[model samples]
Target: MAYTTLGDTGLDVSRLCLGCMNFGSERSWMMNDRDASVDLIHEALDLGINFLDTANVYSTGESEEIVGDAVASANRDELVLATKVFGEMRDGPNGSGLSRKHILDQVEASLDRLGTDYIDLYQIHRWDDDTPIEETLAALDHLVETGRVRYIGASTMTAYQFTKALYTSDIEDYSRFACMQPEYSAVARHEEANLLEVCEAEGVGVIPWSPLAGGFLTGKYERDGDPTDGTRGAASESVRGYFIEENWDVLDEIRALAEAKGATPAQVALAWLLHREVVDAPIIGPRSSEHLRENVGAVSVDLSDEEAARIEAPKTPRWPAAGKD
Candidate 1:
C-alpha cells in the first residue's frame, strides 16, 4: 500500500500495482471469475493499492471493462487506473497499431469500456512498427490535451525503440511516455541492456512486469522434482528455458537467503525489486487472495545486503533491467 512517484509523471502510485491481465477470461489464464475479480479489486483497494494496470488488447478489452466497473464504486480519487492501446482490437487491416485512427478510436473505446471519463495513464502496449512514431505521439498528446489521458507510457519496448520515442517526443513537442513496462525478475535480467540506463537518463519511471519471472522465483519448480504440474511455472516455456542447470545452485543460494530472512522465496524476490533504486512499482499478479497477501507482505519484509547479494542472476551490467522499485 506504500505509494511512490510514478516516473516523471509526478503521480503517486502504489509500490505494488494490481495487474488485471486476468480480469477478463479470454485473454488470461488465471483471471476469469467476475465475482472473484471484483473481490480481488476491492481487496487491492482495501490494501491501499491504488494503481491498476490493464490493456485494451487484454481479452480483447474485457480486462479494461472489468476494471472500470470494479473500481467505479470505489473512491475515484483514491485510484490510479492505467490501460494501453496499439494492438489489434479486432480482425481488420486497421484493427491495431498506433496510427492516429487506431489510437484515437481505442482511447474512446477504452474510456467508455472502463466507464471513466479520463484515464490516469494511457500507454502503447507495444511498439507499432507499421505506424510512424510521430503519428502515435501526436495522437497521445491529443488525448492529454483533451483530458482523456493524464500521462502516456510505452510497454515492452526495446532500448532503441524507447530511446527513439523519447527523442521524438523531445523534438516534436508531443506526448511522450513517462514510464517503461518491461519484464524483470531474479531469473530474467535481459532488460539490463541499455534500456535501464536510458530510462535512468531520460527520467522515465520504471514499472516492471513479472517481477517474479512468471513464478520462477516462487521457488517451487526444482530441477530435482517432478517437472510437470500445469502450474504457471511448469506451463511456461520461458520458465522451462530459464530453468537451467546452473540455476539450481543459484536457487539454493536464494533458498538460503529466504530462510535467513524468515520469508518465502517470493517475498524475498519481490522485496529485492521493491528496494531496487530504478524500479518505481513492481507489478504483482497473484492467482488468489492468499497469494496476493503473501506477495503484499514482501513490502515490509526487509532483506539484508548479504542475503540480497546471494541471489543467482546474470552478472551485473549484463542486465541491470530486472529490479523495479
Candidate 2:
C-alpha cells in the first residue's frame, strides 16, 4: 500500500481510501451487515489501507457506527479516519446544508457515530447554495481550532466555488480546504477542464470518488444490453448515467489495455488515476473482501504515458461553460 500526504498537510494516508458507503443494515443497496462490515474493515487495514471515509448521512449514520465498531481494535494512530457533513441527518431545516448550525451539529453527531473524538479530515459533502460560505468556513475553522477536526475538505463542487472557499479562508485566517473529492476516472475526466489544474496549482490534494465510473469502467456491463441485475448501475439512475456510448468506447480501450497488461479493467482504470501527479488517492467502496483485495492491487499497476493517453483519449467534450477547446 503506497502512502502519500493528505493534500498540503503532513498527515499520511493510503493511496486507496476505503469508502464506507457500502456498510450498514438500513439500506438494502448496502450489502454489508455488521459482521461483514467489520471483516472488510479488518481486511482493508490488513492490506495497509489506513484512510477510511464515511459520511454522516450514509445509511442515515448507521454506516459510521459500523465503521466505528469495525476499527475499534486497530491502532487508532495509524488510521486517517474521515467523514463528511452537509447532509440531512434528521427532520427539520437544521438537519442539512453548510449552515453554521448544520456543520457544528453534524460534526458532533458524526464523531459520536464514528466512535472517535477527532476526525482526521472532515469534508463538506457538497456546495451549500443556501448558506453563506463565510459562515460555513468560520464554523469549520472553529472545529479545527477546537481539535474536533484535524483538517477540512470539499467535494464535487465547481472550481469557482472551491476557489472562493479557499480565498475566504485565507482572507479570514480560517481553516482552508486542504483537499478535493471529485468524480474522476478514465470514463469521467470532466474535472480536467479546470478543477484538476486548479488543485494542482493551488497545492490542494485531489482524492476522487467513483474512480471506476461506478463500476462502468470495470467492463462488467454490456454495451448492447441492460446492466446486470442487482448491480448499482442497474438499480440507480445516477450510476446508470454512465451507460452512454462514448463511455463504452472508453471502456473498450480500457479493456484492451487491461488485457495487454495482465490486469483487471478496474485496476487499469484506478492505475490511470494513481499515476497522475495531482491525485492523492482514489476512494474505493467495495461491498466484499474480494473486491477490496482486487482494488488494492491497483496501487502496483503502473501505466506508461502512452497507455494512459490511450485510456483517456476518448473523453467527451466538457460543457461549453468551461470554455476549453
Candidate 3:
C-alpha cells in the first residue's frame, strides 16, 4: 500500500484505489449484496487502501449507500472518499450534466448517501457539453468554498476541454481540477495522446478507471476461443469494444510478462500503470476477496524498464492524424 500525494494536493491516497462500482444490488451485473460489500470494504481497509472511488450513477446511488454503511466503522479522517456527479439521477432537464443545479443538488444527495460531511474528491463523471464550463467551475468552486467538497476532478474528457476548464479556474480564482479519471489500461492507451500529457504537465493526478480494460487485460478472455464463463467480458457489452486483434497482441505480451515475473496478468496490467510517471493510482473494482487481494498485490509487482516497454509495444497511435515523426 504505497501512498502518495494526489497530484499537487497534499491529500494522501493509496496507489490502488478501491472502486465501488461493483458493490450495489442485483441491478448491477457485477454487484454484491450489502453484507458482502461491507466485508469487501473491511478487507480493503485492512489491506491499507484508504482511497475509495464511486459514482452517483452506479446502481442508481445504491452503491453509495452501501459504501456509506460499509465505511461507517472505519476512521473517517484517514480515508480519502471520492464520488462523481453526472448521469441522469432523476427526471427533468436539470437532472444531469454539470449545470449549477445538477452539481449543487447532486453534491448534497451524494453527501447524504455517503454519510459524510465532505467529499475528498468530487468529480464530474464526464464533460457536459450542454452547460458552459464557467458555470460548472463556479458551482464547483462554491462547493470547495462551502466545504462540501475538498478537491475537484474530471473524467473522460478531451485534453482541450480539460485545459479550458483549468484555464477558467485559474482566471476566475476557482477550485482547479486536482485529478483526472481516464480510461487507461494495457490494452487501451488512447489517453497517451494529449490528455495524459496535459495532466502530467499541469500536475493533475491521473486515477484511471478500468485499468484492466474491462477484464480484457486479466488474461481471462481468449483470442481464438470463447470468454471464460461468468466473467464480465462474457456477459457484458462493454468488453466487446476491446476484443480486437491489436489488444489481443498486447495481452499476449502482458501474459508472457506476467508468467516470467510470477504475477497474475491483472497484477502485471496494474503494475504497468503504477510504473508510469503520470499515473497516481489505478482504480480496481474487485467483486470478491480473491480479486481484491490479487489487485492489491500489484503494488509490489515492480516492472523493469524492458518489461514495461515490451508490454506497451503494441500500442497504436492514439491520434492517428497527429502522427509521430
Candidate 4:
C-alpha cells in the first residue's frame, strides 16, 4: 500500500482510504453483519491500508463502532482514523449542522464510538448554510487546539464557500481545512472546473469519494441493460445518473484500458484519480475482502498521461456535477 502525506502536512496516509459507510445496517445494500464488517476492515489493515474514513451519520454511528471493534488490536499510533460531522445525529434542533453545539457534542460521541481519544482527521460532511462559517471554523479550531482532532477537512461544497472558509481560517487563526473529500471520478469531473483549482492553489489535500462513480466506471452496469438488483445504480437515483451517453463512453475507454493493462476496470478507474496531481487519496468503500484487495491494487497500476487523458476525453468538465450541492 503506497502512502502519501495529507497535503501540506507531514501526516502519512494510505493512497486509498477505507470508507466505513458500508459497515452498518442502515441500508439494504450495507454489510449488516457486524462480524463481517469487522473482518473486512481487518483485511484492509492487513493489506497495509492505514487510513479509515467514517462519519457519525453513517448508520447513525454503527459504522464507527464497527471500525473501533475492528481496529481494537491494531497499532493505534500507525493508523490515520478520520470521521465527519454536520449530519443529523439525532432528532430536533441541535441534531446536526456545524454549529458549535453540534460540533462539540458530536466529537465526544464519535470518539466514544471509535474508541479513540483523538481523531487523525475530522471533516464536515457537507456545507452548513444555516451556521456561520466562523462558528464552525472556531469550533473545529478548538478541537485541534484541544488535541481532540489533529486536522480538519470539508466535503462537497461550492468553490466560493470553500475559499471563504479558508480565508476565514487565515484571518481568524482557526484550524484550516487540510483536506477535501469531493465526489470525483473518471466520469464525475465537476471538481476540475473550480473546487479542485482552489484546493491546488491552497495546497489542500483531496481524498475523493465515489472514485468509481458509484460503480459506473466498474463496467458492471450497461447502457442498454437494467441495473443488477442490489447494486447502487439500481437504488440510488444519484448513482443512476451516471447512466448517460458520455459516462458510458468514458467507461468504454476505461474498460479497454483495463483489459490492455491486465487490470480490473475498478482499478483502472481508481488509478485515473490517483494520476491527478491534486488528489492525495481516493476513498474506497469495499463490501468484501476481495473488493478491498482489488481496490488496493490501484496503487500499482501506473497510468501514463495519454492513458489518463483517454479516460477524461469522453466527459467535459462542469461545475456542480450532477447531484452535487
Best by TM-score: 4
Alpha-carbon local distance difference test for all models: 0.82, 0.87, 0.90, 0.93
Measured against the true structure, the TM-scores of the candidates, in listed sequence, are 0.93, 0.96, 0.96, 0.98
Model 1 TM: 0.93
The total number of steric clashes, by the backbone 3 Å criterion, in model 2 comes to: 0
Weakest 10 consecutive residues, lDDT, candidate 1?
A: 316-325
Which has the greatest lDDT? 4
Per-residue lDDT over 1-325 for candidate 2, one digit per residue giving the tens place of the 0 to 100 score: 9999987889899999999888976655787568888898999999999999989889899989998998888999999999998878888868789999888888888898888899999999999999999999999999999999999999988889999999999999999899999888877777887588889989999999988877887888898888778888788787778777777778899899899989999999999999899999999988887788889999999999999888777775473322211
Candidate 3 matches the true fold with a TM-score of 0.96
> Residue 27's C-alpha lDDT in candidate 4?
93
**CA lDDT, candidate 4, residue 97:** 95
Model 3, span 28-73: residue lDDT tens: 4666578988899999999999999999999899989988998888
**Which sections of candidate 1 miss by over 4 Å?**
312-325
Regions of candidate 4 where Cα sits further than 4 Å from its true position: 322-325
42: Cα error in model 4, Å: 0.6
Give lDDT tens digits, candidate 4, residues 143-163.
999999999999999999999
Order of candidate numbers by lDDT, starting with the best: 4, 3, 2, 1
Worst 10 residues of 2 by lDDT: 316-325
Per-residue C-alpha lDDT of model 1 across residues 152-184, encoded as one tens digit per residue: 988887798898899999999988788999887
